[model samples]
Target: MRPAPVVLVSGTETVLADRAIRLLRDTLRAEDPTLEVSDLEAGSYAPGELLTLASPSLFAEPRMIRVDGVEKTSDAFLEEALAYLRSPADDTYLVLRHAGGVRGKKLLDAIRGGLGGGVEIVCAELKRDADKLDFVSAEFAAARRRITGGAQRALVAAFSDDLAELAAACQQLLADTDAEITEATVEKYYGGRVETTAFAVADTAIAGRHGEALGLLRHALASGADPVPMVAAFASKVRTMAKVAGARGGGNQIAAQLGLAPWQVDRARRDLQGWTDEGIGRVIEALADTDAQIKGAGRDPVYALERLVGIVASRGEDQHSPQRTG
Candidate 1:
């Protein structure tokens, strides 16, 4: 298929958006070795700069112009871009990256709807376990390899907090091993790392396993996991549960409304089995105190997190007792 003259990459997922841009550059370079690639930040460029870069060269060589942060672009740049789009140079490929905002909707709509052979590539953020699983599977498939479901879950659990790290892990595994990726493979490569991420701590705490949660929290801190993200994870989980509990629709509908994957909604529903509104409120209050303590409102962040784990695990058990204040 012929490449589009103008490409609009829209999304907040930095990793995916970056991958798309790289793939486009690679494709153009392969087709023409003399392709000239230029990178620009829309928020910092001078007026008429885009037109000058996209203008056909004296030798008429193939060129690819990549402009990032277009959502914060200047009006002058937008006007110049829109004018150039009307009569795009045949040897030029323009790539615009926007991180999902309404700041430049006029230019965005013009590019998306104009007759310049434009293509819109979505790089929506992946917030659900299922979406991350599909990403892992796709990575393996791209390399003509296979990964077991257990292995996929393990990888996601290990690096759930960072998509870029997860992608790097997939690539590293592919490079380091020739066998099909499996749960055993993940354990062999990232066992200690898995125990230290916030998700692991949050998982056990939300399951009401106080002992396991405390142990995991200790291991996580000892292994260099920051206290801030750990508490943030707790906040994230509780917020998701609250959203799911208060939602009025089915899994898919609620997932869409919450920008979550359907499985996440279902998982949150299951996790809310014994949780009461009063219990959730108490846990949220405890988390707030821990958040403050870790950020200097109190002393001993570690103690704060431990107390938080105890409070969260004990949620829905005794509503009358006062929550521990760090």
Candidate 2:
């Protein structure tokens, strides 16, 4: 027989992939240390190496081939692997891992196509809010920890939608606390600790509280808010200010652009009503500058962000205007 079709796993749900990989690796390692394990990356591999007998790696030991990648390897590799999976060898086990989405769906489809049977195994991703709850409950049960229903909801609410972070929180709670895992503990550990979202970032910037905005920015950066998303939020606020500055009415356009649908943009415009047209123009320019900074143009992003926030809060661009709004 040949080797098993590489067990193709993929998702943005990396925690799931990681947990599965850990279990498979440990189980195989415990079963046989001398198991010739080969880890192949999708991008780094060619289809020829996946073929048996003709290629090189023919050893006497029970060889397990594991492939991990950010994307599907290729059609050639998949086709070759499927042929191999038709009659997999007893001495070998093949496992493939991917961070799935639209990104690496080819491998998934291949596994589901022809070889999905007694000899083959396919584990698709668990999605939806309900599925996530079930996962959390099952994970705790597997770990022999008990969690209450309210506590579970609290955990999800407080940690946002990040499964990895939620798992970490659960593991930490399990390790640190001995209680039955109550809602109070979830509130204690993960409350007021929610991540900063794009909307919150916009709110901070528009409030013109430079110090708070800078602190929130730093906190967000530390909390895994990527620079691209954050700058996208900044761009949103800049576009709002630009439109509001150009108009005497239609604050709705400004609010819509800022993701503040149904919110009173006029109220916010009133706050910046003292800001001259030139001041708003400079603010827009500053946003562009900071966008470049966050994207790696400037050396110190934090300092650049702080500088930009300070200028916006202080309305420093007013000095450059030939006439003030008053």
Candidate 3:
């Protein structure tokens, strides 16, 4: 397949955009082993620099030029790029990356409108659970492997905050294991990382599983999870539960009122089971005290965290029990 004279890889999702560019580069290189590759930032180059780079090489070798941050490119650079697009070299492949903005709308439109037979590959951000799940599935599919649904969800939850990290994790799993990816496989590989995450600890504690919560807390700290974020996580969960418990109306309504995702509101409701208003209050109060201590007010932050976890897990049943305190 012949590469397009110009390709616009646009998106706010950096990881996806980067992967698209890499795939394009690899495809080009496979066709021509000596394909020259140049990665440039549009904003960093002066006027006419793009044209200079895209010009036919002295050795007449096939070339791929990747220009990132085109949305922030100067007017002069844009003008030069447009001019080059009008008469693009057959042997040169130009990749323009715009990170979803109005900064270079006109240029984007012109390119998409078919200037130099330009093609656009969009890497839009994956915000929904479905989209993320698709990404995970695609990653596995690329390796000619399949991941169990349970394993996919676990991987997504484990690296929910960072798509790049999620992709890296998926790639690592692919490289490390030849068998089909399963829930147990994901847990075996990422269980330690998941245990240390604040949400994991918070979930166990709020579910009133004292022993499990305490074990998770100890593992988290031992795995280098800081005391401050751990406390903050507990506080956040308690606050959400309190809000959901007190809010009137259906789950969707409460979710909107609290600015939480519907699933989050639903989970909060479940976590509120057997948690009286007084219990919620007590846990929140304990969290506040632990937060301050972890910050600086008291010594032995680790002990403070353990106490907070115990109090939360006990669900106000034994706020001052010797077992809890110890």
Candidate 4:
């Protein structure tokens, strides 16, 4: 789709905002290879700068003037930009990038009020796992590339802390291979990261492989993995298992009810195998205690982590299996 005369790329998600800007530039360039691109810093914008860049060139080539740091625009910029909105120049696309602040509320309000006839491309942060998964899916879908649900979840779990890294990983996969992406593919590329290592430990422990779980856990710690998120990895999986325990319905329906993705429901169902509600609850308690210990309750975080691994590896049988009270 062609960009509007005025485009507002607004949000705190830098990666998404950058992508939006790049896509606009590419689309404009495709339409007219003579596209004249220019960058402006709103924070240091001088008087008459916007008009100068937006004015018709001698050859009358199309222009895309990208103004960044609108969230911290100078007073001069604020006045000029709002005035320019009243009568935007022809044959020019004014792209505004605001990273979110009250600094330019007047300009943003004007744009949103239809002053410039601009369309906003919001780049809101993907704060939830479901949102991030959708981002990965969209990235592949845009390129007609196929990625397995498990692979998507793996990529999300591996880079949940950073959306930029996750997007980069998806791009690498897309560029490096034409074959459908799978979990093994993601693991091959990003398995060495501490986040993946933490999940690996959690997966091994949850699968009841006590010895292997310990090995992975120790290896992760030695690799300088933080105990907090490692414990968090266990907490995340066990909690999903707990949510899926005794829940009935298809993956999609159950996932909708639990605010999880369908693949998460399926994975949680598989993880719940050979596990009882009592076992899940027990492991959750272990996770809490371990979390506390690692966060300054206990002197030896390693011992606490080891204890947690054993508890999870045994499906909570490491402790006295608490009987359910009617």
For all candidates in order, the CA lDDT equals 0.82, 0.60, 0.80, 0.84
Off by over 4 Å in 3: 192-326
lDDT of 1 by residue, 1-326 (tens): 23688999998777787789889998999999999998776766688777788777989999899887688787877878888778898889899888778978887899778657788999888999999999999999999998999999999888875677689899999999999899989989887673337877887888888888888888889978889989988898899999998987544467789998654675677679888999899888888888999999987788788888888888744322234563
lDDT of 4: 0.84
Cα lDDT tens digits, model 3, 32-134, are 8999998666666677677777778878899898886687777776887888878998699999888777988888998989988899988887898888999
> Model 2: how far is 301 from its true place, Å?
16
Question: Candidate 3 — what's its lDDT?
Answer: 0.80
Name the candidate, 1 or 2, with the larger TM-score value: 1
Candidate 4 has its poorest 10 consecutive residues by lDDT at 317-326
Could you give the candidate ranking by TM-score, starting with the highest? 1, 3, 4, 2
Better of 1 and 3 by TM-score: 1
State in Å the error of residue 156, model 3: 1.6
Scored by lDDT, the top model is 4
- Judging by lDDT, tell me the better candidate of 2 and 4: 4
Q: What TM-score does structure 1 among the candidates reach?
A: 0.64
Off by over 4 Å in 2: 1-6, 10-12, 52-59, 98-110, 113-127, 194-326
lDDT of 4 by residue, 60-100 (tens): 99999998778879999999988999898999999998878
lDDT of 1: 0.82
Worst 10 residues of 3 by lDDT: 317-326
What tens-digit string does per-residue lDDT give for candidate 2 at 1-326? 12343455554455565566566667777877876666655555676776553233456566667765535456666666556667666666677665544644554565667563312333454556677678778868988988999988777665443465567778889889887888888778765453435435555656666667667777877876666666676666666656655554232334556555322343345446556677677777887887898778987666666566666665644222122133
- Report clashes for each candidate as comma-separated counts: 0, 5, 0, 0
